[model samples]
Target: MMTKTKLPNKKLAIPKKKIAPKFRDAFIRFYRYMIFFGGRGGSKSTHIAILLLSRMMTDEYMYLVYCRKWSAHIKDSQFKIFQDCVKMMGWQDEFKFNQSDYSFVCLRNGNRAVAKGLDDNQKTKSIAEPTHIWVEEADQMTFDDFDTLNKALRSLKTQNSFILSFNTFINELHWIRTTIFDKEQQYELSEQFRNMDTYLNHSTYLDNPFINQEEYLQTLLMDNGGNESKIASDRYGLWGQMPNENPWLYAFDKEKHVRVIPFIPSYPIYLSFDFNKNPMTVKMFQMSPQKGLYDSFVHMIDEMEGTVVLREFCERIKAKYPFSPFFVTGDSSGQKKGEVGYESKHDSAYSMIKKHLGLSDKQMNPNGYNLTYENSRILMNQMFYNYPNLYIHPQCKVTINECEIATVDEKSMNVHELKKDRGTYAMDHFDNMRYFFQKYFQEFARSNYHATK
Candidate 1:
């Protein structure tokens, strides 16, 4: 007892440094893959950047790399995080910044960080397997493109991690949902980040403490009262598509399917046509002169290929309707010259129409056109919602699907949004449908619709 007389009392010390909560916690979270998802300005990039630097601060020879899609893009947007956090954390001049390439690191510790973007396949093919991978704006790249990048991460044999941060304008229809959101699925991320084992850590801009606490900042100030969904999708990390964003889009709901048109009218017949070489599209509408609108109940659709075959489909539709007062409304697109390097698809189609079939001549009317792309977008997007008489034929699924997904690239699609014929055939039919409506509307005011005595 005498020998055990108290050893000199020793004081216990605690860590004076404070964890930022997001990065500090993510560092300990056990998951093979960690996803930080939320609305805009949610501090996702900052959190991950801090975490990567923290790992570097602790150890030597740490393989730390950050990337987006292109090498040029990364050094600017993603590289800034490394530069800022290193300085903030007091890693001073210890790190090297290469202005000419996509690699850098702190000299004091053997930790290195690289930043780059995946703008093309060759760039992706050149990357070495990363110990950790960060993909920003993952939604911008196609599933196939991102999948290609994943190959580089496989080189990490021990303690490797993949971190994803993004704001999605696209929704559950994407592959990410199936891979990560589904309940029964298992992820490699679970080994390191414990939270990954439970469920996805879905965060939003509001959840981020960095945002200004006041209610009147940024998105809160946006004035889109009637278009709240659009605001949410665009500004708040929600999807751009509303429940019925496109009125022409048909619901698969069996409950809404009425075999018979609830209201039929004795009115003048009208026609709307959209033409395509692959699958032609045509729509028919009934005019209501009293209301200055078309009747939704009377319509038709035809989508078939080949001149003789499509012509037959067109004739068959006309015969079924059996109204000589029918009108054709339609549109055309400029196609790129192929191996022949001559006139485009629009030219070929115009030549075919003028040479063989005597279709309506008035296509782009000078009086009705808009002066700018912005104005044209407003006009085109407004059409589906404003027409009270516009209704989908219960059977015309193709046209309905077309109207829902047919997007116009306001800027040219040559670079970031390239697809020679992606999401196109549907558009052809839609163009035909719109053209037919315009044709009928041009002369409909004086037709039998207003002849009642």
Candidate 2:
């Protein structure tokens, strides 16, 4: 009856020395907006988890919201990280985890941490005022999504903070880059953001004390199979190169290929189309066929999207280039009967294009077929490298953006095909360009055919 009863260890000890030096200060202090972005093995997630757990354990009113792009991703990611941190700190008995909704509560205090996904708007909106919000894989969310989340941290009683942790795989044009990193560098902020305090810290695998012990990670980071972009992003925590690591048009150089190419009204306008409903795309080019293949110039003067109706799109093109004669080429799927939304159910897309634009069958690419994806990739890359005269107008932003970001399927056994699952309009504009090139300059499809000759 007098036997001493053991009490659970309530002490929380975060291995401060074990934490990366660059991120140690983040655990002790608070910033309105804290950004921890870098390469793999940085311990960014570990630090954030520890910080949130510590805050929740100490403060009764502390409420932390952990978010990712998808709800399904939270269990394996942030939720796991928190569980590991709790176990490592020997605080397992002090907290209770709810598996159903991916939440946990500090038994010592009323503080709680819940996981939410940005994709589930209803769940995200249902969350009451949270003292802290952490967005893991922050780059997956657009600026609007981030802004909405940031605005939701409206608790006045506690010191509210927002944390963003992500890898450096995003390109220069990404919202995280343009808004946070770039503006931070330039010391520029709008009136709305001037009141907020922001802190940014970058850490790579080298910054991790235990990185050497993780032999697999070390090898993976060191030997990236000649993918310089991946090495730069995953090892060094540098901004990724535009167009991604395995860009479909690897040979494209924006400075060399994109320029102010004026419209040649005298030359027949070559129009290329891709008929995805949401963002039906078109690219307009004019060619000087009199010049030799290498010397001849094909200037893409304009690009348009979002006019889904074929008649409306044709009218816009006519209004823009009223006097120029036009030639047409597009996705062979346009040849199929009953391609929706672009035209009436009775007429095919090509027939509608011919009718609206008043084009003869001779002016259109008579071939009612599209080049294979592999073939298109090869020919487009070849054109970018060897066809020096091929240029996209500086104003053709959609085409330029596609050329810069469209990537090949690096994971597949056949790596030549373009990756198309990114979004509905992911590669629509790029496909239009490829279709036009393959049909209009069929000779370029031959691997042996030199553009210069």
Candidate 3:
């Protein structure tokens, strides 16, 4: 005969100070759906574990069904998290663990917590009267898997909740962004979902209180191998760019490089052009001095595109910035007469720009010859890493879109050639940007070259 140990009747006290402030409110409140997402080292999983354990201690009817994409992953992830939480809370004796099934039962109130894999639908469905469901790495689950688990929360008496936690690794077209969030490109809570008992919380490694004590985590987050998408999604917790197989501007991260840039009247404006009959494009830029890390910052203020002649495009620029001083640079081919349009057969594209913008030969800085595509790609990507102060104005949507989607031909002998199959003006704006860098910032662009011994 064995004597049963008496369970403590006192309520467990959760240390609020240990919890990141961004997650503390959600720990105490009840919402039908709670989403906690961000970059690594945010302590999101640890907070969820403590919240579930605390609720189990308090609510006598608590039944949690914790799940991931596969059942085999539960033992190492969610199960270990709960086990660590129990030890951290010093509640080891209050719970009975079933190691074989990855579950535990609270000895005090008969509450239970079980781990299931979304891969095993029947096992997840068999969890009767689940009061709460937690889907870790929710980005891995499809809509059907989410629906199945959502419908499993059938307890009529208990206030049911569904929790989702993940890094912002998915693209804009993903169901989580399109269906759940109102705006595809923003990080704010959706007003439509907020009214429907949904709670959203975002955090980054900077939010972790323990980050100061962990130097390795800080170094890893800081050094992302110059991957702009990783820097955006991992360091800043922003929506990642759509993955491209052979991106032309591989280091272009909209999160790091796009922002609201105001025009400075004191700085002379630079216009870079890419001339085409169907749709001519021009990018406007301004340079400002900086104190640290970088000597100067390049601000792409605006972009213009239209199916018009060189004269018409110049008129549009003059109308926009009537009094501002302008410098011109673009395609070396623009130097050839009779190529622009019927309106200016005698004047080359550069000459037409000079005539319309009232610029001198000193201001006209077109390269004598265009840099090879291979050289341009190498130099531009090098600048993106070495000079981190480059930025594009949010209003320059065309430029931003081109930077994100433009791809190169990896199979071609000259792999730097842009993939022309995307569309007629697929890489027009990208070319305009390249021309600006190669002509105006030639010194920085040539820094990557090494002389042969």
Candidate 4:
């Protein structure tokens, strides 16, 4: 809309950068969606006004609106910073604040902006299409909410844009990821935030050199140039999770491996088996990414032996999934030849289990299971962060609990992705997870770049 592809990058060298007003101008001039996330005490609001003012000056009295979920929260411009930006920019007579009624600059060009709320999001289209929209604490709102109201601001032409500003917090499971994180899926994602970063060059309280170091920031990182994560999530406009999140912990995150009891035969089934000693276990992972699957939970009993023999496990799995693909992976611990006891039980488990269960050699191969512990971590992280449809049956209660509580190796501090470090006692249950993940990741890795659903 500004006829410019790139607004000039902000003055990175400037210290004590309190020019939020200047930053706002930059955001509106550059792109359609701008998000400003700054550290505590950063002049976030100051930047908003300046950017809004920039739109007004360039678009010439474009219809603008000052928004807040609650009307009472709007603060006074009783300070010089606000007074200076408003008066210095020659908008001295543009604002009218009487008791609770607040309205500013209702002009077509150099005009006024109405006071509005999310309750009336769709109702915000009386004037020309909005050139820009600003959202604070966008994390609190849903994707559906943004869509319902924000899109109504689209102008008849192209000057329309939206701005999002918020302090960092939990809620990383955001809907914006489809739009901001991956641009190609704009059709599936809301278009409101499609180009947010182009306009938002990231903001932090420290970026405002106007903040006095001695009086504001000092020995502590908050007062000084420290606290990297907070700074990144808040100022850099990155989506982040808070420390208090339960999923953030490595040890308590796994779902206990419990087998589902009330098995429902609704969809085609697949069994990815990983046999183990003592536990003598097999898991039935349901493949339903698009369509919801049964509540296939798992149970990891402390007990080793059970009537549910390896043969029965296989037969039951086959009975459930009949004629569908049932992929299997093993330790191959027994497959190795020339051991001290070459014919030992450890070596024969794979063949014995498969033979008893009637699995064909083609159905059980080492194709996708040839990865190490480190490989598992990378694969899991990808699945968790990138894939949304992965699930275990609710009956796999033990599996889910175990997975949620599963911990990475102590030294490596991950599921098994070791760089230079290594740890003892390889994760037993975690190792078993390879079967399902292998099938999923292998399929994903081969055609992911060209994937379409």
Q: Which candidate number would show the highest lDDT if scored against the true structure?
A: 3
Per-residue lDDT for 163-192 in model 4, tens only? 776664333324444445445542122454
Candidate number that wins on lDDT, 1 or 2: 2
Worst 10 residues of 3 by lDDT: 1-10
Which regions of candidate 4 are displaced past 4 Å?
1-30, 75-84, 87-90, 97-99, 106-110, 119-128, 182-197, 218-239, 243-252, 255-453
For model 1, how does the per-residue alpha-carbon lDDT over 7-114 read when each residue is reduced to its tens digit?
A: 111231112253344444465543456687655666677777776666555543467556665456676677787777667666666678887775787576566776
lDDT of each: 0.49, 0.77, 0.78, 0.48
Which ranges in model 3 have alpha carbons more than 4 Å from their true place? Answer: 1-10, 213-217, 242-453
Worst 10 residues of 2 by lDDT: 1-10
TM-score of 2: 0.64
346-443 in candidate 2: lDDT tens per residue?
88888888999998888777347777777777777777776648888988876787788887777677777787643312677888998888886667
TM-score of each: 0.52, 0.64, 0.52, 0.45
For the record, the alpha-carbon RMSD of candidate 2 to the native fold, in angstroms, is: 8.8
Per-model RMSD to reference: 12.7, 8.8, 14.8, 19.0
Instruction: State in Å the error of residue 184, model 3.
Output: 5.8
Residue 429 CA displacement from its true place in model 4, Å: 24
What value of lDDT does candidate 2 attain over all alpha carbons?
A: 0.77
